[model samples]
Target chain A: MPRYKITFAYDGTKFAGFQIQPHQRTIEQTLKTVVNRMAKDPDPAIPVIGSGRTDAGVHALNQVAHFDFPFDIPERSMVRALNSQLPLDIVVKKAEIVPKTFHARYNAHKKRYRYRVKQGEFVDPFRRNYTAHYKYPVDIAKMQQAAQDLVGTHDFTSFVASGSQAKSNVRTIYEAKVYHDEALDEIVFEFVGNGFLYNQVRIMVALLLEIGNGQRPLNDVKRVIAAKDRQQARMTAPASGLYLVDVSYDE
Target chain B: MPRYKITFAYDGTKFAGFQIQPHQRTIEQTLKTVVNRMAKDPDPAIPVIGSGRTDAGVHALNQVAHFDFPFDIPERSMVRALNSQLPLDIVVKKAEIVPKTFHARYNAHKKRYRYRVKQGEFVDPFRRNYTAHYKYPVDIAKMQQAAQDLVGTHDFTSFVASGSQAKSNVRTIYEAKVYHDEALDEIVFEFVGNGFLYNQVRIMVALLLEIGNGQRPLNDVKRVIAAKDRQQARMTAPASGLYLVDVSYDE
Candidate 1:
């Protein structure tokens, strides 16, 4: 058996998520189907493990994943082969032979995610489907300050969705920042963490949005973290604005 | 009746096109529905004539349109009211009172359109739905020169679609230029023209793409235009990458 590392991107609008579902379209299923066809196996029961699970309508710029195949395929040829079978909205950017021990999910050191929100009276027709549109005037300065409070290791239980089944709620967030891209008329929230609880990024964004809109004070972010109750946080932001930017692992 | 001009932007992914269709979702239909509701008339036959009819999956940043309303509505309030009823993908940016004779489609003096194509092995997930993905390396210099030949007034019959029913294809092109946006890994094609025939932009893009990929000679653009035959042009580019950038009327 040979293991291969693959980097890919997807629109995520038509996909349920990266995880495989029984009958729904997913990134994992799409990848597996394409890879199997390329490997000359009609129904290869290959399991693909992604770096992380993105919610519905969440996109990925550089998502990393790995799968094991029974036969050897040239790395360069694999990229072309997989892409030919994949839909236009999804593309395999790179494929490389990796050490058998490399695990896409377990070996990841850090993951970065970005959430985009348009704060204006008019939304760009081209970007409307991919970005969250909010007409309420947001205070970017307030949001930036609130984002700073969310950095560092802490129990993110309050930010996790109520139905999340993660065993531990504690995670170390290396960085959290919010800024406005004037050219794009979008507010971006970026986070890099060792691991994130389910819906953690979306909830944090929701909290910052509340502060940005003056619905809550900037200091409310710290109180929300300390409270450790899901009820204490603001509503979860829509999934359309969220993106899995990149995943990294130690060599 | 008081006539009002409205400037709007929309993500055209979900729209059939900018025109009203029978039992089909369209940007024009949606806007007319909102206007009819606000007019306090049951099934009011309000018509929203756009500056141009963008194809399905094409976006608009500064699209102009006008409709006659029997009641007076403040400019700012009209924007807010229409936005409240419209989907998140469509937004009314500006609204102003215009002369009773104002016409959205007929009074336009010039229009500008932009076509975007991604030129890298890796596609941006955030932009995949909005940009055309072209993995082949493009010869930028040749494409730019080819675009230059397309500038100026001439019969654009070659660039028109086969089923186009326009009486005249002679339109003046003020400017036609192609440039690469390195930061975004995109090649942008901009054209300022008095008017465009059906699928003219897409056809021009396809010809440029053929030149970029070395399938057609750089000088072939002039020959295609001279031929004035729709079959002389290359395939029509996808509509997802096209955008209606602006519309101008003589003062």
Candidate 2:
């Protein structure tokens, strides 16, 4: 058997989630179904493992995944075969043969995520599914200043939602930045970290927005992180505006 | 009865078209449903007349429509009421009280349309519904040069599709331009005209693309228009990439 690594993107508006459920459509299950059909062997189906699970309505720009095929095929042919069978909402950008020891999830060193917030009172129908709408006025300068406290290693227990099953609550954040996209009238938040707890990114975005709205003090992010309690950060932004931007592995 | 003029936008991916149909979901029917539901009137339901009909999968950024209401309501309140009940894919951007004599369709003096073509070999899942994919190489300069021939008043019998109901094919084009969007990797074609026959903009776009691909001579547009034959223009671009950008009226 040969192991393959694939970089793919999907519009998650129509999917249940990344993990498989009995009667629901999911990213992992869809990929496995396509791969098994191509292999023509179902006794022990090929498994599709993603770097992480994304909630429903969360999109992906570059998601990494791995699967082991029963036989060797040219990477180009494999990509073409998978894409041809896959639905229009999903696309495989690149495929390559990798060492058998490589793991899609465990070998990943860094991940980047983006959260988009539309700054306006009215929701644009064209962007309703792609951005979270905020009606209040936001202070961009204050949001940028507060995002600085999110850098460096810290115990992010306050940001993790209740359903996260991670064993450790501590994570290192290499970068955290918030900026405005003038052309799109959107506020984009970017984060690069070792990993993120479930709902961590969305929760952080909610807290940042509150701070920018002047409802919370400018230094509230520091207090919230120090508290290490989920109750301290109350709101979680909508999942539709989140994107799993990129995942990196130590090659 | 007071007439209300409204400007709105819709994501047409889920719509059958802009007209009322017996069983299909349409933009006009959807808008009328919401308006009638708000009006609480049964006999002679409010008629929502749009500036023009948009084909299935064709989007609109600022579509104009008008309807007569038995009772009067503030313009701002009308906008809010319509948007609150309308689905997320459609949004009412503006509303105004107009005279009873004002008509939505016949009173329009100018219209602007845009066609978006993606320059790539692969389909981006995020952009699949918004842009038409062109895999072959294209010459932007040649497309721009050919578009100049379309900027004058002319009989567009060559560009009119078979289903058109217009009495005459003569239409005045105020502007025709082709430009590239570097960030999105799209070649956008814009046309401003007094009026267009059925499938006129799409047919022109297809011919311009063929010219850009070097399949047709540079002077083909002039010859095609002079021939006054539908057979001269063979292609109509996909409706998914076409947009009713704006409609103007001489108030």
Best by DockQ: 2
Worst 10 residues of 2 chain A by lDDT: A119-128
Worst window of 10 by summed lDDT in candidate 2 chain B = B119-128
- Model 1: colliding residue pairs: A125-B10, A125-B11
TM-score of model 2 (CA atoms): 0.96
Residue-level lDDT tens digits of model 1 in B1-251? 77889999888888999988898899999999899988885554878788878888988988999998878888999898998898877888899999977788889989999999986675555676578878787888899899988899999989998777889999999999899876676899999999999999999998999999999998999999999888889699888899898999866
**Residue A229 in model 2: shift from native, Å?**
2.2
TM-score of each: 0.92, 0.96
True contacts kept of 1: 0.46
> Relative to the unseen true structure, what is the C-alpha lDDT of residue B207 in candidate 1, on a scale of 0 to 100?
90
lDDT of 2 by residue, A1-251 (tens): 89999999999989998999889889999899999999995787778999999999999999999999988999999889999999978889889999988999999999999999996657877788888999899998999899999999999999999988999999999999999987677999999999999999999999999999999999999999999999999999999899999999996
Q: Per-residue lDDT tens digits of candidate 2, residues B172-235?
A: 9999999998767789999999988999999999999999999999989999999999999999
Q: After superposing candidate 1, which stretches have Cα over 4 Å from the reference?
A: A39-44, A139-142, B42-44, B122-125
